[model samples]
Target chain A: MNNALPRWVDYGLMPLISVIVAFVISGLVVLFVGESPVQAALLMAKGAFGSGYNIGFTLFYATTFIFTGLAVAVAFHAGLFNIGGEGQAYVGGLGVALVCLSLDSVFPWWITFPFAIIAGALFGALWAFIPAILQAKRGSHIVITTIMFNFIASALMVYLLAGPLQKSANLGPRSRDFAEGGQIPKLGGLFRPLGIDMGASPLNVSFALALIMALVVWIIIWRTRFGYEMRTLGISPRAARYAGMSEVRLVVLAMMLSGALAGMMALNPVMGDQARLQLDFVEGAGFVGIAVALMGRSHPAGIVPAAILFGGLYQGGSELAFDMPNITRDMIVLIQGLVILFAGAMGSLFTPAIVRLLTGVGVMPK
Target chain B: METILQLLDLTVRSAVPLLLACLAGLYSERSGIVDIGLEGKMLGGAFAAAAAAAVTGSVWLGLLAGIFVSVLLALVHGFASITNKGNQIVSGVAINFIAAGAAALLGNAWFNQGGRTPQLQSEQRFNPIELPLAETLSSVPVLGPTYQQLISGHNLIAYFAFAMVPITWWVLFRTRFGLRLRAVGENPAAVDTAGISVSWARYRAVICCGILCGIAGAYLSIGVSAGFVKDMTAGRGFIALAALIFAKWRPVSAMWACLLFGFLGAIEIRYQGVALPVLGVVPVQLMQALPYILTVVLLAGFIGKAIPPRAGGVPYTKER
Candidate 1:
């Protein structure tokens, strides 16, 4: 809304300050937990990037966030707040599990992978389809319906895992382990030419898929007519309606696309990492996507870095927790909360100050 | 008859938290502040109350501590929405995450019991208090046991929750402050024209919302449960929001709506393992998902349309 500020100041400077504020507060929390903040920071850095193994883990986590972040961004572009990413991703995992369980013994990985993608996207889109239709047709708020769907999806997942897909009564409520067909090959072997030992990291081909999807999303949202209309819908629904754009179609399509992206997030965790569907595999990644998309300004260029940063936080926070028992991974969660607070909620707090500073510096003529 | 009476009692018990949270939402939403962070605030209050009660061994202190923490969170929401004119939903989401993370981090660090406070003794909890003559009149025909079972034996907070319904109705319908508060939600410009500070009125409403939510959280921990469990408020906050919507944001209607949902919850707990004639056994997940599903259906206008307050979720600006 403030066109006076340059793009760099708006996107780059704003998020930078928010991240800094989040970090400083997080440091205070670490100190409160009876640990040295400086040492915790050092341990976190070393833990996130110390070895190729850690990098792989970081990338693995990043891949999950990328898909979910894009999903939220797509919905954001359509004036829809899709809080059902958790549910869509869960249902998408269900689709992947169905494909893996059915075809694992019959086909190899390559044959099953494409089908899994289709199934994942289809199932995820299907899960999102209901809330989308409800919002479009009934004028029901997407936020409430989508959030309710998350709980419903969770319940559905529990029922499926325990009732039908469960392997046996002896084990926990999880699907059978996928065979060679379902398990995507990790990218560790690809790093061997650089003389780096990947060391049992779970980074897989999904990382490339995630990157490609990011580019695809950029094209879909920016370069396509459908994307333009969705953005128009978001910018001002009244104007879009005046222009004779079918509000129902745009809302439904945008939500389905968003849900598909969220559903595809299951690929990174299920097929790529665990190779089986389990309870709560989404693990609040959908919520994390909200923070990511907001901080990224719903752009792929911004989302990738944000995703990686959070991934590092997840990986490094674990390392910190291992070393300092009092400081758990929740420290990163606290930082995430602060980031969402500063970057998303109170995101415009620094804008007025930045505008004044920029004008004072003669960067912009008042 | 006895089982029916017990179910009604359980219904009242479960409905108390929902009722308190619904009233909380009523105050905030009626003031035109969309509080998606009700869940988070209740969660934070639950942790604060349990931890305080555990430390001080006084349930009163726990209730105060819970209210204090919730009010702080409500202020955060108010600051974002009113002062900064930031996105209300985003602020609420941030509040939820922050409360959730901070509660866990602090609980784990302070208690060292894996994100759970130490179990409270009777002295540290809000034990149920029997009304006078409850035992003496137990032998009276059909009315005696009903009065004793349903009306007489809930804890102090439970009585306070019921008492709040009439008080809230009185305040909202009869008081001058309540008129201004409702006026702000409906037409902030009109209120602004009257030379009243919109933000100040909203801040007060948000604070009131916070107090009610804090009481709800304290009730969940000290009133019903022994101690605080992580995520103890569960989805009660959201369900309360749903009840607010279903009740059309009115005070007395909210009570009826919450009691209905509470009855459903009581039925869910009672008939969880019982197999019906057609369906083999009702799944636990089905029961857990019912409230959310019903809210969605209500939202879809299958039963009735839920029209939110005018100007709700929008930050007030003079130009706008």
Candidate 2:
């Protein structure tokens, strides 16, 4: 679909058109549900950004999305679809849980946070390693393996939560809450010294960490030698091989790094927000990352805003559901699905038209 | 002996949906359109069938409605991937998400049972058909019990599922349309040069896939269960895909693969808390995860290379 058009129009106008189309369709759906689309949209905006607390919550959700989005982007750069981010994040939660449970009472927050980070990365990487090895060595398709791993991870989480990790006295399928030392400091506390009040939202120091990770990903993907080799392989494996790059090594390395990023996503929910290990903590964020990656064009800079947009949707959709009687939670999911459909799948639906218009306007060479 | 018969019966019942879905995948993938939206189509069909049956009280109408909804979704996939040349997998994934959300929203609106339709009446459902002379055959020896247990009591659609295997095989291998379909999957350029429209063949194939997936969905709500539950297909569509791959995309092999997966599911349900010798008490979650783990193992080329259609995921562009 790439054509002789300005890069901004190619990346910006096309996606904007797709998003507008999606929202228009979603508005019709909302009308069918006997709700006012205008009201719903207004409420969503208010809920997502009106108050300090709402902004905090939105940013918190965005923090997790940033991690998972980068995870998907990293893999996309290597021509791999790492759909197993959900599973990787799940196992990564288990890592955080283990660190919090065993050492929270004994160690300080500074010490436990770093250890948990390493544990999360290792567990996520280990989860991804099997599929990576299979793809690299046995020629198994990465998409199917990663998808299967998601279900496997869900089942594994259910088992561990019920059998070994279940809190001793609690009957629910969740681990015991972490101690104070294991819990990350909330942003509300950080803002106390200033005149501004951030409110008691779950937005924590992890948000800053997420931003740092994004920068790191940008550097790794754009600046490093490994990044060049990965992009070369993604563009043409035959060319990479001709240049004496080891396809197997790069495939495994890329997947591991992707998995590690997905695993780091768990830190936000487990350590920052939930302060405990719970079943389905990853929810659908890992899958949502695919939409993020696609809409962002797998660029770090693009991914940050894409993640924030989806985070706003998540937060705002809940608010709409709360405010309206006819509009249910599923309706919000339906809208999100429509967004994903238009933005990711039917992305090229309007590109040719735009390209033609641009050419007719003498904006670019035909 | 009785337990074994019961197990076999349950396996057939469980395998029926998987068989239909696997064949559905086979048709689409053979025509070179990879369908990960089988789960979504099945879910949509199940909801449509159940809702229509509850409203109209006609099982046949329910079946038609289900097929209509599934085909509608398949058309969406076709438009995105075939007409627009978009990513097929992303389209399929989007379809799944849309179906999951739509089923929940519409089911709740229609039935008010939190995304579940009303329980279907017996006459409005596809009840098991007791074969003629089953009682007389019961008087016979070993073969009598086997026939009665295995084949006699399944719904009409289950029989259709079993019959589809040979039909699919015949259509794919012996018929002219089948040759063109297979040719398109392997090399659309060749098919195009030979004067067959690649997109038309793919659209027809996807529509056929939709009908099969519709049957699989209808069987779930009206035949096996009594109503539609939110996301009731429960990854069976995906497992059917695994079965399709496990069978190397052949019709007869797909049947065997579905049956194998069905047996594993039967074991999971029948022996939920049963203890075994070496492994001790097997966890239910382990049993639930077995099919997927096995799929991963199979996909790793442990058994053999599971080759897909040569041009399976690639969208056909005439200029390209």
- Candidate 2 local lDDT, B27-82, one digit each (tens): 99999999999999999999999999999999999999999999999999988888
In order, the Cα lDDT scores of the candidates are: 0.91, 0.89
Candidate 2: tens digits of C-alpha lDDT, residues A89-127: 999889888988998999888889999999998899999
Could you tell me which residue pairs clash in candidate 2?
Answer: none
Residue-level lDDT tens digits of model 1 in B195-226:
99999999999999999999999999888998
- What DockQ score does model 1 reach against the true complex? 0.81
Model 1: lDDT of residue B105: 87
Candidate 1 C-alpha lDDT tens digits along A254-313: 999999999999999999988899889999999999888988989999999999988888
Segments in model 2 whose C-alpha atoms lie over 4 Å from true places: A191-198
DockQ of 2: 0.75
Q: Mind sharing the TM-score for model 2?
A: 0.97
Best by TM-score: 1
